[model samples]
Target: MGKVRGELRSHCPINFGIEIFGDRWTLLVLRDLLLQGKRRFGDFQASEEGISSNILAERLDRLTHYGLVTAERVAGDRRQIRYEPTEAGRALLPVLVEMAYWGARHDPRTAAPKSFALAYEADRAGLLRSVEAGTNPSEG
Candidate 1:
């Protein structure tokens, strides 16, 4: 049900990237991974947007196939798996942050966090850095 690149396709990185994440829900899932560190099914389902289980499963599998997310079995729980963002996935945080900021500005009543709005107003780079720090605490 999605577009596939043909052998005759030209090389446009943005187009290629869009093919991977141009869907309505994919980016939202990526946002959850990047912003909230959501790794399990329940965490994703608990999102205010309410994604269905089947769709979440499919999205997680797709993201894993695309190398954006890596799913590994939880230790001592063979039936459970945890999904985490790969480095490629973390690279999309800026885009999500920008989109959130734009949504907040266009709609005064947007329900995004006040901290995000304040950070957007002051310095998005700082916010991104903080997120990166949170994700990689060992770097310090």
Candidate 2:
């Protein structure tokens, strides 16, 4: 689990996790970073979910506070900032993958691409490595 900034709701692992990322937008932001390689604020703004600037800002702030992400100004470009996931954030990849798998199995209208499911099942570790390296496995 990622580091908690404030007092946790309880000692239960599930409750601690929920307190950190239970919000609707937090997981989506993580998806963009982990899967889509989105780093810039504008990139997140362009996500299909259409998250507003205010909400995105808040989520990013919270993620940073929890040590899941690191935000830094781009080299030689103080006006532009990039956000990258820390190790704790990358550790959530398995959770997201499992959730996607569950959704694909249970939801008739699931949107997860079949290719991704196949690759995930074929080599889960390789897929995780590719994602952690900021590469889209489907593209490679």
Candidate 3:
């Protein structure tokens, strides 16, 4: 069955987000946009997980439709498109940070920095601020 853009399984707050980005690939796409400084289709395709082109297209479309991402054509290159995280998407920083922190702490093979948890624990707000500052906003 085909799903509508922005469609949700329920009105529950938690369910709302889960419905939009419950899939691992979708979340990874968001991670790329929000945390990894990725902007092009090719960049996402080259992700560590090696997502296929088809799924990447679908997830990008879904994120754009859900207002978590914005796709815009760059100047001087009408054929090139760049994806950026929206304010709504940037709002997920804390969530991503927590998830990263958990993984770093629990996953023995985690590539996250050894001091990540400590630095995050010492100044969570500062960490969030830095990430927010670094996030590239959509161009006008």
Candidate 4:
């Protein structure tokens, strides 16, 4: 792998992409947005890895700025703002799914949940359906 040089903004497309989500927390925040339907600070705080409030706030802001996420106020709850994935963000689903499947397959200690393992075993179409069902509100 080539080393990143002085100014990141001038790097190639790959470097630019990594610059946005190169950190551990950024992808975790994206995972929460996709799998858990977490749209608020409190919800993210309650996730398994227990991200810090300050970090969560910063990630949300960055995600919003990158156009991967959009914030909207909950109807009838002016104080509650929800963060949701945009079309670009939703396009990352396949990448996340592939990563999960690869991890479950290669890592002996992963202990992936039964449903996830089952989905990994199925055909791509079936696996995508399962992922969609899990992500959609009515099924959740």
Q: What is the lDDT ranking, best to worst? A: 2, 3, 1, 4
lDDT score of residue 74 within candidate 3: 86
**Candidate 4 vs. truth: CA RMSD?**
5.6
Any residue pairs clashing in model 4, and if so which?
none
After superposition of all CA atoms, the RMSD between model 1 and the true structure is: 4.6
Question: TM-score for every candidate vs. truth?
Answer: 0.83, 0.85, 0.89, 0.80
- List, residue by residue over 1-140, the lDDT tens digit for candidate 4: 12223357756978776877778888888888886678887888898888888888877887787788998889999898898899888777777778777887789888566567665665666676666656432222
- Model 2 residue runs over 4 Å out of place are 1-5, 135-140
User: lDDT scores for all predictions?
Assistant: 0.78, 0.84, 0.82, 0.75
Better of 1 and 3 by TM-score: 3
Q: Which of 1 and 4 is the better model by TM-score?
A: 1
lDDT of 3 at 60: 88
Model 2 lDDT per residue over 15-89, tens place: 977887887799999888887788999999999889999888888988999899999999999999899999999
Candidate 1 achieves a global lDDT of: 0.78
Give the Cα error of residue 27 in candidate 4, in Å.
0.6
What's the ranking of the predictions by TM-score, best on top? Answer: 3, 2, 1, 4
Model 1: lDDT of residue 74? 92
Residue 102 CA error for candidate 1 (Å)? 0.9
Error of 4 at 45 (Å): 0.9
Candidate 3 per-residue lDDT, tens place, 1-140, comes to 12336556789999998888888999899888878899999999999899988888888888888888899998999887899998898888889878988898899998887667777777778777766777322111
Off by over 4 Å in 4: 1-8, 133-140
